[model samples]
Target: MLAALVLLLLTFALLLWPVAVTGGIASSLSYCLSALVPSLFPFMVLCGFAVESSAALWLSRPLGFCARYLFRLPDCCAAPVLMGLIGGYPAGARGTSLLLEKGRITEKEARRMLMFCVNPGLAFTVTYLGIGVFGSPALGLRLFLSVTLSAVVLGVLSGLFSPLPSPDKPGAERMESRPGALTRSVEGAARSVLLMCAFLLLFSGLSALLHEAGIFQGAVRLLSRLGVFTPNQWAAMLSFLLEVTGGTGDARALGIGPGFFAFGLAFGGVCVHLQVLAMFRKPPIRPPLFLLCRLAHGLLSAGAFALMGVISPMENASTAPVMAGIYRPELSGGWRGGASLALMCAAFLLMVPGETGKSSLRAPGPKLISVAGVKFPLQNR
Candidate 1:
């Protein structure tokens, strides 16, 4: 009820604000809603449901195998990794929350999993942002490497700070298989995807209102004056805070240079983080640790961008050929090859489990309903 009231109040304010009305807020709001509700939201929900039901079980094994062998985390951690990689940020958080609810992962493990679980997919990062928006396939590769590396580093650091029990530990138990688990997984995925999409649309519209009111632009201007950021950097930061696509769009419009673009991509949009946190809230996951991870990501991405800037010429020249080499075949307006490759990679990741023999499983049951018609489920497995 509090959340609903807040949304109502926010919407009322946006509607009444003259500046928000004048700055194309209405149009942007319409566009955002249309994209999310009828298209993106449904797709995401269905995808989540499908993945959780069918793909998760198969994927958990390999993820469990990998995490146990490489990171020493139990099999439970694998679910979040799989969900995050396939379903995007919220999926990861939802998965983590589910694991926590089931007592599959300890609080410390949940915190650490939340830290590095939210990430955009390779297809979205590479195809949409890199090719569609930035017009540089090469930029996509660099951004991919940057974000992936950042996740790995942060994941490791998070583990270091709050280590999970070793496989040999007495409390560490292998995940057990259950009957009809696939169906339950699907339902949980569906619920999570729907909740996430609703919040995403709401926030996406709010972001549009802010943009129209010049609130976002003003914020960018203020940050740019801090001396460390270029106009592009400021725009990227604003977008990151406000919305990922918007920030990336702003960066593309600036056309500052490859260095700045790389920086923006690596940093991700602040709005993306907000959207991610919003999704996690639905599952009632802890937010502070996720925020910490975002902060760390921003810092690391900035440092990486700075380092790239120092050797800008060499990095640019060397990266060009590599980008060309990887994407050369797709230049003829064929996305199938790239799409296929991404699907294959996703499949491989989904299939692999961490070392823990236990499968990270979400229990099958109806979500609890309150007097206000709110249905609360424990977690997304």
Candidate 2:
């Protein structure tokens, strides 16, 4: 009743700020057009194709060892973990949901995996933050490594808390190919990208309304009075906390360091959180758990970034260069970026054992249908 009343009141207030709301929505749409659609859409399509084509299983073979031994998770988890690390944001969540939808994993496993499998993409962290924001690709690489470390730590810790069930054999013995996989992948990616944009626009408008109402300014003033940060710092932090994209310029502008940006990347802003939530029809993880994990991730990333800063100062760090073409800021957000990850996954695919060389291990769950040379899982009625 209270929540409903509050929402109703907020809705009433939003109607009063027509120009601000419209401007925010327009800016968000521009961002989607220039940044989100161009960078994320292609990567999402690739991720969807990887899962739908069952190439994920083959690609998971190398990471399977780490998933099983280090994380103490089922082998099927490697694919989603990879997706989260490489594809970024909701990609990992998307992969987990796919496995759940296919009945390859239980809801409990999906929930646990989601704790660490949602992350910022390497391109965004390295390219946008490193080069675009800081003018130092080395810093971006360090930030990416920091976020990855935190996720790895969380994955290991989650395993300790919620151990997998015994007799957890691999999800499938062989890849299940589908001729329609590409088309389905493209369609699914379209839906997911649209949903993400919807959430982004919604949050952008809400943030504008809040700004017009002086809510953010009031909070900043209150916090500044308590000496948490200066009014400017609080304002900048609040902006970055609510929406990472708009405020993710130079952290030094607000007298902050890379640590703040690192935290934002891991925490992923409220907008990114909503985008992730919208990916699932029914979210497997509770909101509290999701928030807790993100908080931990942010803290860990900040700490990692700080540690790296102390150990390797930026002046000295630039001497050690990353991949020339791949990590370059311009290429990292486009088709080449997605292609690089796909190629890497393909390279790993070579390590997987062929059908004749593999031992048969199966789990009972969904029925499979074979058409021509392709296999598809029958949807549950």
Best by TM-score: 2
lDDT of 1 at 230: 67
- TM-score, every prediction: 0.63, 0.77
- For 1-381, candidate 1 gives per-residue lDDT tens digits of 999998897777677765534343444455445543343333354434433344445555666676665455676566567546544555566666666665666666666666666666666666665666555666665666566667777777666644445543322332343455556666665665566554445555666566545566567567666778665556545655555555554445444444544444444455455555554434344556555567677667656655654665332322111233454455444687677778878877666665775334433453331212222221100
lDDT of 2 by residue, 1-381 (tens): 999999997888778888778777897888788877777777777777767776766766777778777777766667777878877798888778877887767788888788888788888888866776666877888989999999999988888866654433444524455688889878888898898888888878877776667686677667777776656556657767787775463134444566677888888888888778777789898888898999899999989888887887666333122344545676576798899879978866775558777423333554443322223332210
Worst lDDT window (10 residues) for model 1?
Answer: 372-381
- Deviation in Å, model 2, residue 170 alpha carbon: 8.1
**Model 2 stretches astray by more than 4 angstroms:** 1-4, 161-176, 249-255, 315-381
Residue 245's lDDT within candidate 2 is 70
Question: What's the residue-level lDDT of 346 in candidate 2?
Answer: 82
